[model samples]
Target: IAEQFVNTDLGGQLGDWLDFMKVMTLSSDRKAAQPDLENQRLAVQVMTIHQSKGLQFPIVILPFLQSGSFPSSLKKHPIINRLPSSWMNWEQDTETTFRDIHNREERRVFYVGVTRAERELYLFGPTSRQSMFTKELESENPQPMEIKTMNEHQDNSLSLSERKQRLLADLNREIAAKQIDNARNILDELEKADRGETADGSTPKSTSREMLHLSATKIETYDTCPLKYRLKHIDNVSERKTRATLEFGSIMHAVLEEFHGLKIAEQTEENLKYLLNKNWREDAFEYRLRGEEFRKQGEEILSDYFRFIQENPPNVLKRESPFSYVMDEINVKISGKIDRIDQDGDTLAIVDYKTSKKKEKAETNLQMALYTEAILRDAVPGVKGNPGKANLHFLRHGDDPLSSHQFSEQNLQDSRIKISKVADGIRSGSFEPDKNEFNCRYCDYKD
Candidate 1:
């Protein structure tokens, strides 16, 4: 059956073979392609780590092990660093819960790879590489096999001792050259400074001061990439023109706010559409075709939104109507726009609206949570006998449906704790940029 399979047209098929003999024959073809395996070898299967999770291999060659490689140093930092203390704690707890799930999956893949080897298993990688698995191996086993270059593995390869000597000589030569160049540059710079040449031919005493009000966004940006934050916030680089999505969001926000402000009886689909047209910029639509698409999406969203509001208007008691409110300021120099402030008797509620895609796990966003804390402590006066509740309403992306989360006192306190830590980090200039692969993939600064 194996001989017939190898010679027949059926052997050139894709996918798994169910027949026992066919499976064994196919596996042999894969092994033959591998360098270490010759006769009786099977087909070589190549796949990414993610794809290879369930599969096992006789040999695994993980090349290019470096500081920024596997078990990446980037994973040390958390993604939601600027989260409010309460939310931060909650997120951390949730993260811990999920961490085990991820670790188990990783372990399963590793186990699959290890168990795959039948007769021989070879794990080859760079000698100078630093990976989590590599580190673990080094810790468990004091001695590790030295990695050799292709030339070193050749028939006429140099001895290990000779290779070391050659490498050392090359390093020494490079170091000597670098030292000489540095000494020459320093000497030239000192001579110029002594002769009043102003080093780079610029006045040294012409320093200027620029006020930079650091917000949560700015802090997060600085943490992601200091150079980016400096270029944008410090140097005041002009941002790219707003995209269609953002423009549409702004238009929707404005129209929605206006619609809510109107008398309940006065609300009409035709009037709302008219308001949308009036507010919409002629050039808002980048293209005529996009404009039509935008109109269609807008109409659907507005219709749904109108129906939602009509069905469920603000549920305040008749006596609780016209909730008078005043914005409080925190002396901490932190400033944020409170979207809507409503009062119910002695209690005040801070409401913020977010229009984003619905997340499966919608924990309180740290920034907004911090804002709530600020309002409770700095903005709302406990001494004046008027303390308010904080609520966040996230409107589903491209829809009118809302999901809300209320903040407790504990949540506010947690926000304060996270904020204090962030503030300390900022003051101490310890905000380090984290290069998380997930964030790097989408980050504007990533190159």
Candidate 2:
């Protein structure tokens, strides 16, 4: 739409038009165009206080209402706070402290949440002691209301195990104490329970299990921490965070995928820049500053990538190829999308892109091994025979970007064995948390 408008009104000024569009999209006026969800459906809606702004519902249930958790203590960003005020152009307000600002925002959020309930508003918190805001809200009402316990209406179809009961108790305790991380962990435990997972790292005797399905990410995640893998892949509990690096990597992958689809003659640095410009997402990053920083980094990486591709134009056979291979021994199916594949002489070459900080070795990389084996087994259409080479194209590494290695029969056999072992563990429900510090550092379920 911007392109069409630019062509018609601005005489084909695409770059300027793109800048204008971005500015307008980021402006506060964009919220006016948001679809009203109040009358859209007759189902119960679950949303955050921010999402509930300017919208009302028939019933609003505000769960996990605790002092520190709901209002959230005034916490400053370590890096941002340490930076000079002059550098950030921050103006210090002598009258208002950081805590004041935090309190005001929290109060506004609570107010919005309270007003969202048209007919009934259910506020849940600790029975022993309530949140500071809860006192203020209750004081306004001043009248006694009927109370109910959570376990009054139990479903006949569902059975609450002792572990689940303990988890529920723990969730209540954590919320009362305003232990946010502990509450999240308990919530994950409850989700696992709902999915028929036992607390003792064993599958239920009554439940029938299916054949294990594996992907490169699944294998790697299981290897990193089985509990994390089970929570993410099995129970489908995603980590809630707007990671700038992941967002940048996704944009890079999308742009490169589209760029590689073009003819070799059409693949130029200018075209690559145009692709980046076209696909750049401002909302993906948590902060606008970080987004701008990544945008600059993207241009540099793409410039290097464009030069490298021009110098050694690959015989590209396929782009973003999806393949599924079944392991006969373990009866486990492994599936993933290969970034690119090149016809290297008599054999095929599997190319996988990476935006990781560290370059990966093809010999040790399970993804490369899996992709190579899949192609060799004729699992991927239009590709056959043993892989001549496996390439890990590290986009972040300006120097020594490509890591190429040829897989031996022994390496392939070992990978299969590894897969078999992982499958066996998963099949038996061995999702015991790996408590390694390195593995737990950036884990979503970390407490």
Candidate 3:
């Protein structure tokens, strides 16, 4: 392309084109990512399965086909809850047993990964710890090209925790040997032994009597998946993958808090942007480029929020307000952070900023009712007369419209009853794993 421009004999035109291209490239601030695709380039190539979807290769090697490496744990899929489960048509090898949608997708991707190699294909993983396709591979009786460790036949008596650790260690060593391609990820996992906790950074004590404080989230986790709650709160297990969205939401909340905390004189666009930069997090995003994009997206969301405020600014009385109350009915403490409290005429409105694209089911929103009850009884500073309304500000939407949930005596009472029941259920110490699978992977427990 440069040669074509040079051959045009337009003297300064080629130089102008080069300068323009340079500016365009630099404006994005994204570093060089793609490798030279030319076959004669004589450089080792690497690409993710999704990236190589329609592309073919002369020789392809797929690493880490062990369980949880490809299909991932079914207990928590980012896209699973986007739509209702009934709409999905289950795929299966034999029609009798319904297949997991995520497992089916993984199988299809594995096929694609293998078929890409027209000449030769290689797969690397621990032979004893194969993923979903392990049973089929064993039935076929295929031989492995290499064995990294001596524990070819794992002992049956080994504890589940022990087995998990061994497998994790093996995967890491294997990854390190494979040109240390994923060493950073491995290191991050290894460094997680001391991390993963509740928002307050408290780990669950083995003694039930020690746990005097139980938040709404804690109760919700137990109700949704008991084993998950045990692993996360009780045992404290380490998470395998980074929760980008969770971190993204946290950063957004911090920025919003800062935006509200500022005085009117200090609430300029530049100052707001500075607060965003101060609260900006790069660790949550998958890559630096994505982090940059997220920061920019955050700024845009904030701008939209600011515009909304200009049009219809409610009297914000509190920012990132904390409220803790003991549910005397259940004898458990339910606490949560109310994003904002605003005075709407005669009553106070509890507002929460929902960063997610999906609106949380209004009926299932126990926090709103819980906060309202606290405000009405406790006489929270913002509530002038009666504690009534709650607002969910969805920042992602184009118009930044508010979703309001009005408080009714019956519904509030019902919410209290539900909370009490859930609290009692948890206090009973019965934790059943979700039918799909154990949600240990996504849990904050890292024992």
Candidate 4:
């Protein structure tokens, strides 16, 4: 109000009037005051409607029930409007008008607030300009009282003893009610404990809750932003619809998996093109023109990759190999899929496909180290040795894209320690967000 007063450039006369009003409000019956329950320190809880969700109170007061205040005017979604009806399954997923969606969400929030009162609910606003919701309720044939005047009291004010007595009576009633609720809650908890059940009425697991297996992808996500990892993994929050780049990567990986499954002689340019066309995502691209551009790029990339492979064919040992490595010392299990493994002389070479524009360094990359360690620990069949080399095969790079790194003992150990720290942090529920502006800009769970 003070800021608004300044912004509105209200003069000294208006300021003096505001000061008088403030004083009048403070002395009024509706003056803000906490309950005087010292022993229990009980007081009326004040919170937003959102915070009151799924919680029932004896009495709930909803203020600012005016139409403009409660159900504010709808905001436009410019991006959604500009998007194609079929792009990213928008129509199929929503199947409703944007205004309707907004109204439904607002209604749900209002319903939650209303239902939070177990016994009594009070709604305050200008009777002349009531909320649209009040009209909706009226349509249901509910009775509403319109008060014009209160019955004249014999005394305008109460004496000190009379006020004290009234306050004491109200306080005692509240205290008794609170005591009964607390006792009931205690009894319920004791009963659940005796039955060997959790507070949620489910049987408790014997194993430690901290025992969790993590994927290389999960560890990398946690390293980048712990909150993102928790929201996606622990809370099972759905990520934003896959962008063209991610969908492209997925489709490319699928095509390569099928292409490499065949013998070297069977892997020809014609066959590669066939596989690419077969596995191409039609709906992944936001625009048809962009899609065509990507398709042309994919064809060229596949052609170049096919030529490179034909010139120097790798001794493919296993393709799309799944492996799991358990570090018993830290009680951390690492699981991931290696894109390809090759028999490079005496030791095995771990190859992970990368579809991104940027190249990842194998030495410092925890994902590469994890795959190498797993293979070295005999996680993959017929492969039991240290990391001869780890290569990040960037599919975006048509010719000579393999970034290889031979990990020393210290590098591997450092990677392991880092992995352990990530595991410990996740187990301890330490999901603090990394507030890096660059990362947060593209983060789906930034909120």
Candidate 5:
């Protein structure tokens, strides 16, 4: 592409346009178009699936026609399964009765996408056993013009000419890679200033790392995949982006904290909304519209929580309180924020807000248990020696909350022991990745 630009009659103009595009991409948070594209003829438009709705196009190119890419994965949630009143009049199919709406919705969305193309619809789906879209495209029962991938070479799927072309391309790529490597080696040799004192210069410092503080998230991350933890904590290679889910969680946390921290008289819906507005991070989402949707969800969740608390309040004690406990015996310390702490007479209750429909297991939740350990270790003012109750307030469930299982002093003690062992392993450079295909979707270290 660059070669074509340089070889063109308007070489200087093309080069300037490319340089301007590069500057725009670097200066902006996302990729941006050239300013002069508006003045140019034969304009092309690019947009997301949601943005393409109700708009017709002469030609449409749908790339990455995979299972999740088309309709996305639908999680099993309590509210999502319950159908609304409008679907009652439709034929009572298996999808309407059982858990098949996920697939049905996927097909419907794809149909809408295809219908938008009046003349041509190009579906570029890769051939994979796991991709349901690709399998259907490969089948005979097809009205859509399925453009078979030109890269198909296995099992005599390609013509002789195509195979020859592919082989030539591969050979050329190999040669180019070798030439680049040789050039780099030559440049490195030329750049070398010192030939060394005797033989092979001074040896580099020994590669050894030190262990730092440990937390529940750290332990859980390490347990999930050691490579993931090392990539995040050690290498600092994160897939950080404007994430809607993470941003929503943070927004809800702030709203809840403000709701509980204020006095009972001041704890109004308006006041809570004010706190949400104050803490609303618009830049944390890829799109401003998505951030608005998250705001709406947060508002509803907060309203439900505020109403529930008014009816069933538990003498709100603390909100968004930071706590740290040192274990010199294990040479480790745990630090975390307690979402909420409730006082029930002499006993105190630990509460954590969960955004997802799924609940964190009590046995594995080192957060509250670790907090309880601090109270047990020393004489806390409000809390008794034993924590009376622990609750997981799942926000997605509306008013419903999942009660935590019974946790004991032994649980807390053993948790510390586990942390100590993990810390020691980390110090000794024990980083073994737990390879599970199930987690590759979420693992940043996989690629």
Candidate 6:
């Protein structure tokens, strides 16, 4: 029985190989081995809403749907709500407006989940639960299982402190409204009090103009969400530092930069290893427990980096030029520490080293595009050069071949326009926190 079952092709060649086990097997054992067998053959799939994209399934059971379940109610409101409408059209069409953007995306995902069922579909829900999808599903299908489970009793009751908080909130709103009324009454009384006073009065006390200092990030923040910016900057709420991949990338970058700064002949394997040991931060282990694994990975990365540098030693002619500048600035005082700036007489090249795994199509990032703009405008004076002429190098992990992108002025400008739009949104206080499951999983601000 084991031999026959093992030899039976489950789906394809891979499936056949997976099923072919040397030991004895049972129905329970096989079920345990392939836990997805129920949904696998039933033409029904039980998947998280995100995984349902770009594929068709006859039936999809979205068991959990609640305020904090599917479309998490924890999403922070957009900064646009605080803006005094001279800046943005808050009353625009629901589909086009920024206010409804997140809701629309959520609805689209819900729609995709619903449409995935080719034939008969079932949407299960609890009592008192309502959503756009819930309404649509009920209207379309008409019949849905209404399951009501007994609510568990809790030992704890509302505390005195909790009651006090509710009372205080009510009192505060009443007090605020009363205060406004009182202020108006005071203004009317002040006119009667000052009936005999001169129009000029005694010269009003001089007041200082509040200084406004703005950075590129500040401007961007302002456009994204004014309220958020106010909360972050004016209120001085410190954003907590969380898990950042930048730290890992920085360590690798520092090592490579050091490697390049050394004399060409001195960049040997032994010397590189010595530099890696000297520069490595022992304290970084506190964030991630995979310190030993990272060390091994770092060693592997160093080996690859060393080989690439040896093969493509900095071109001397390209390096020596007035067009090339390190840590150049773009708009908003935005500057980047360019790894290698190369100039071939009329043409310019910006090379950035990445320690990430290689992708099929190497693309230019916003940071790189900004760097190219800075180089053209700030680094090279009076040179109305073509943006497409510039070179971009992406050095990946392992000794794989470098991926290159030719920077174009048009592309750079287009990138700037998009960045500026984002900046504008932030400046106008329209920035909203996009709720994503992946983000929630890794986010330090999840609470």
The CA lDDT of each predicted structure is 0.51, 0.76, 0.65, 0.71, 0.64, 0.52
Give candidate 4's error at residue 65 in angstroms: 37
Which stretches of model 2 miss by more than 4 angstroms? 1-209
Model 5 worst lDDT run, 10 consecutive residues: 190-199
List candidate 5 segments past 4 Å from native: 1-211, 240-242, 379-386
Q: On residues 1-447, what C-alpha lDDT tens digit does candidate 3 reach at each position?
A: 343333332332335667756865787775756655667325556788888888877788888777667656556556744555444565743333224666787788887787788787777765333555543445555555654432325433222343234435544455646846466654455445333322244433332433347766776777778767766665544344445667788988998788788887776778878888898755455444556777877888888887888778768788887777776544677677788888888888888888888776454577777778778677354444577578878888749457778888888888777776666556656556665435444444322
Give one digit per residue, the lDDT tens place, for model 5 in 229-260: 76666544544333468768987887788777
**Cα RMSD, each candidate:** 24.9, 19.8, 22.7, 21.6, 16.3, 27.8
Error of 5 at 234 (Å): 0.7
Q: Which candidate is the best by lDDT?
A: 2
Candidate 4 Cα misplacement greater than 4 A, ranges: 1-209, 285-287, 382-386
Evaluated at residue 90, the lDDT of candidate 2 is 49
Better of 4 and 6 by lDDT: 4
The candidate that wins on TM-score is 2
Q: Which scores higher on lDDT, 1 or 5? A: 5
Clashes, model 1? 17
Choose 5 or 6, whichever is better by TM-score: 5
lDDT of 1 by residue, 188-221 (tens): 6555543334547542331222222445567556
Judged by whole-model lDDT over C-alpha atoms, candidate 6 comes out at 0.52
lDDT at position 317, candidate 4 = 82
| Residues 329-435, model 2: lDDT tens digits | 77788999888988888878888889888866788999999998888888887766667899999998866789999999999999998888788778777888899
- The Cα RMSD of model 3 versus the native structure comes to 22.7
Which residue pairs in candidate 3 collide?
Answer: 236-445, 236-446, 236-447, 237-445, 237-446, 238-445, 238-446
For candidate 6, the per-residue lDDT at 54 reads: 78
lDDT of 3: 0.65
